[model samples]
Target: MQRILEPGQIEALASRSVPRLRLPDRSRVFAARAERLGALSRGHALQGYLELLATLAAAQHAALQSLEVTLPNESRRAAARHHGMPVIPALGEARSSAWRGVLDALRTAVAAGNYPPAVAAACERLATRSAEALDAQADRLLAVEVAVGDAAAAPLIMAALQVYWVAMAARLVADDVGVPESSGVCPVCGTLPVASIVRTGAPYAGYRYLHCALCATEWHRVRIECTQCSATTGVAYHSIEGGSAAIRAESCDSCHGYRKIFYQEHDPAVDAVADDVASIALDLLLTEAGFHRASGNPLLWQSPG
Candidate 1:
């Protein structure tokens, strides 16, 4: 007869087998993403927007280099751990206002880079906004209130927020993070995943980690499960017929939601964010087929028309 383990026993065994968190590498995460976006832009239908995001990601890398922020104090972290909450929740008063400065730095860096005239003008317009205005937009972005935030400025504001949180996540000791009750959200910042990646290499081979859209933190989750509703029964994977085998949309019939997942085994260079952005057609088809996005990409903001 086969034996089934209880939840606590399963947790205990998985703890020994799987890595809970893969913290962001402040040095190379954004840089590698920028390079990947640039590479994906060539000969693509969304070349202009991809190129713009490439520049924005490069700016994020520059801002991340000198950016500094304080992590939650031991007391806060302890309290969070006790409750199985995120160590550095992006919402509420936990986030540093220094993220505004990171936004300004990104703006300056992006302005210095080569971009289309309209994009340059948009940067100038964003620079003219008051701190309160920027904060309002940022609040909307962080809270996933996408309908009202300035679509033109959301990406820039989000980039700064990313650098702010990534700096903290990169500095975090993975062991310090609490065991989250749910695997759908980021354990570092409590944000939804941009996408999941089946990574290659020792220690993480064949393992799926959900990439946080905000802080770049990656947390391990078992495959073939609904990341949105955590439904295990009706999860399915979809991809473009005859397209790149590396990326696919993981759809859940239970929740009618979907998220893209990348397989590094098919294309070793597949990036969670970059490849997700480069594959808009898959998202369109899934949306048309009645599945909403399970999570959002930082670089892609949709405004209601």
Candidate 2:
């Protein structure tokens, strides 16, 4: 069994120079998460699938190394100044020529990762989609956590766009208009959050931020507030019998929604995405109690019953 660290023990760790966000170093994160997922798969019900995901994540990391996206400062601000504006251009909103590059990069990532022919083909289909089309489709799918399970290509498509958008956003947002804050959905992309992060290292230590799986951005949300319903009451936390102290689920009674939180101080190895995926037992237990996930991990797909 994995050792769980106590929360108080985590606070004792030193601080960092500044608060941290997860978007900038996309490749390193992907690589480390893949490694961690491989380790986590050693003895689990989802071992085969987890292992496959790790391989795919590694491929994404490699693909990210070579892909460069630069969003114009003007375009970024145009989207940010309005509440309804999307952070990145969607299908038809951007020209086909612009999307071709991302599609090419995704195809390479899929092929390099050695995904099956079906997955490769799926990537190709995603590649051909105009930014407007992808934006529309993803917006619909992300509206409900359960919707992702219906599309086999969902994971691949999300991963590819995540890399592309994060890369450009990291560089562009700094010089553009600031993203407006949203209580539940991501300020950057209007997507629901996948999980919250309890940061590690110095000055950033212990600060909490909600992590977006689609674009890798982190936005601040108070630790005490319910991520699902923004409720201050009836929020609860749960952990497995003997899992690492690094991860757990935060559930809200007000909306019956649950989200994973990664407290990285006690276990610096924790990641919002990888750790969330590895903690399937917590999801099952939470659901058994009537809570449901408010957000979806792009790497996971569920089949509708």
Candidate 3:
């Protein structure tokens, strides 16, 4: 007699070969994001804002070229591996003043581009803020203390922070890190994912990975499960009637939380972060239906009302 396997069991067996984590290519991550943002802005309702983010992403790419960061030592890596925690926990890591220099690089790069007066003014104002104030703002943002952060300045601060972290993550050997027990947060930096992507192509074809909002790490997770609570039941996907076929909101009745998931098969160029922001309408619709977002977009911050 031949043995039979359940679909779930077969899936588990097949998933074993999928790479657990795919670190960002520091050289092209921001550039790809900028290109996607630029494409999304062409005829978008939020064209101006998307374009602004494109400019910021371009700056991030520029800043990243000259950025250098030191990774955690062997002791730290061993400790994190033993405890199933992030190798360089974003919230726990001690930051240096070097990030402020990344911010300056971003400001300089953005200044070279032609932008709206208001946008340029925001960049100028951000540049003039004291180092202490900038550090405080970054702490609030990194901790996801949304209410206390200046919403207008969060994106720029996040851009600089991303450059710093991406530099470290890009340089570190993936073998040095291990998945966290929590499963939902980034294994490299322990930050919430900005969005999840079902990628196309070799090695990762049809594989789903959560795109980290901070360090830009990609970690595999099974599909049709709640990314927040790990619930497998009552999971459904929602999308705008006339929106891009590539994107959808995966809402879980168990957690009542939703995160956008992009299918690269539907659109090969889809970017987890770029498309997440570009499809704000789906978020609004899901919110109206009582499904709250599982995490905030790294490029967009909302002020507390």
Candidate 4:
């Protein structure tokens, strides 16, 4: 079903709004994400794949429990104001040990054997890279991300590293950043969003925010407009005929782009990555209709749309 509204009522009309600032509780993010991953794995269309992801999420949670990171006191204020590209890559240069710790843990997780052999090989290679080598590799992967619209060109291990590293930077810099972001891309790392969430809680009712694929940051965007082009016209939503009402493809005629929108009201278990990964059927439906996605989930390494 399609939903449209007059242009003036939405946030995009503001043209320059503040980033919906948030700092993830490192202690809670992984565990909560693990739960969502588990649920998706147990009862979703991509069950086997989701189960592997669930394990990976749990591993990430464990790694976070022991991760040691230091945040700089300086803020990203000037950069935010100018919409400057993030100075930090997903594999930030600050702590080589921190990156190693995450990669090492991911390698162990991949070796545990539920996933395909290729995943195991990638993690092994990831674990062997030196910090200097990894830095160059990170740049290459990011270049590919830019070229392919976050497609899974890099291995899953690298995607995991991107999320952890970028998330750490975003958290450290989040408080210092201010109201200077109103674009479709992430203000923190300049990455496209995985998907948008319409939260379930009363305080967040009707609020819509795009979840960052690399850094796990969520920034608010208007509900009725096309996230890809900020178009208010020719926007329609499509969903599986008998599936949950909360999830749908927000399609735009202007850009012919669509992104998945998850309504937490109907599915509190919804997660930016987990739900997006589980909904392969919906993606197929939208693709069949010639609508493309603007961004993607890191775990799935989806090509645009």
Best-matching candidate per TM-score: 1
lDDT of 2 by residue, 25-55 (tens): 6657678878888888898888766776787
lDDT of 1 at 270: 82
- Write down the lDDT of every candidate, Cα atoms only: 0.87, 0.68, 0.87, 0.68
For model 4 the local lDDT of residue 2 reads 83
**What tens digits encode model 1's per-residue C-alpha lDDT throughout 1-305?**
99999976986797688777789999999999999999999999999889888888888898889987888889998988888899999887767778889888888877887878866786898889998888888888899884745687778888888888899999888876887888788988899999999999989999899999998999998888899998888898899999999989999999899999999999988888889999999999899999999877888877755
Task: Kindly report which residue pairs in candidate 1 clash with one another.
Answer: none
TM-score of each: 0.94, 0.77, 0.93, 0.81
For candidate 3, give the lDDT.
0.87
Stretches off by above 4 angstroms in model 3 are: 1-14, 111-114
Q: What is the Å distance of residue 260 in model 1 from its true position?
A: 0.5
The TM-score, computed over Cα atoms with residue i paired to residue i, of candidate 4 is 0.81
Q: Tell me how candidate 1 scores on lDDT.
A: 0.87
Clashes of 3: 0
- Evaluate residue 95 in candidate 4 and report its C-alpha lDDT on the 0 to 100 scale: 37
Better of 1 and 4 by lDDT: 1
